[model samples]
Target: MTTLRALTPADASGIRRIYSGAAVTYLMRPEMTASEAEAYVARVIEWSRAAPVAQYVLGVDVAGDLVGVVKLGRRPAGHGRVSYVLREDVWGRGYATAAVERLAAYAFTAAALESLGAKHHPDNPASGRVLTKAGFTCLGADGGFVHYWLDRDGRRESSGQHREGPGVSPGRTRCPRGRSSR
Candidate 1:
């Protein structure tokens, strides 16, 4: 089973490795280019040491293997966004959904955060499903992207009146292989 733990300097190398692997396969727009990936890794290591008040970054280790990550980012004005990425090989096995759910629960209970949000490229239906399963509501579309948010109560609240996107519908009722439906 995958578990989240406080990130430490010892985990940096593994985290960097995961970041480098993801840089090549993930479609996140803000991800660093190949040449800049190393530099970004170094920056994350530095940032990890500062102990920022509202940012909760964790290493997602599954049975001793660092498989992914989940981070809670707080902007200058206290707004927050939670993001996650699983190793490409583990895609579609429900790791992303489990990580997002665990992160949301931690954010609301441990961090005492006001709100958490994320944006999915409209083309990434898998990512949309993960966010929706974690109880995020699609607020609307902007620049052809879908925006979602989860409030402090662990329920979704839309920022504006909008029609449901693909994620708004209830997802599969059956659990994925090797897991039980809750």
Candidate 2:
């Protein structure tokens, strides 16, 4: 089973292992070295510690092994940003969706956040699907990526007229393994 926990310095190697060139390119550009990856996690850990609300980063732990991360980013004007990354091998396991959902639950209630935002490259619709399953509604594309947002009380729409896109329907979501998000 996958569990969510606070990220620590010990998660460096596991994180280093997952943030491959292919994986990072989907979200970021740099192909990080082991030391760089360690430093990145360390920095996030430090930020989490310094935050008034401990809603910064969390590790996705499966059977005591770290496989991925979920982060609640502090955006300007009180909105939050939600993001996650998993090991490439674990891409289709529903882990990212579950982790994001876990973080959203915490952010909406315990952290007292008003709204959370996310974005994905237009080519990476899998991530959009994950965001949708985790309660984000697409806000169309900007700068080669599609944006999404989820507000408290389960609302995820930018306008009342538009509901879903392509083949998506309201309240309908597909898991990473191609199963329904039921």
On TM-score, the leading prediction is 2
Model 1 residue 164 CA deviation in Å: 16
Q: Write the residue-wise lDDT of candidate 2 on 45-164 in tens digits.
A: 788768485458889988898888888876655568887888888888888888999989888787788778787766777898889888787665655566677777787654543423
lDDT (10s digit) by residue, model 1, range 21-82: 54334454444454454554556567667755556667788888877788887754345788
Reference-based lDDT, each prediction = 0.64, 0.74
Question: How does residue 79 of candidate 2 score in lDDT?
Answer: 69
Sequence-dependent TM-score of model 1? 0.70
Model 1 scores worst on lDDT over the 10 consecutive residues at 172-181
Q: The CA-based lDDT of model 2 is what?
A: 0.74
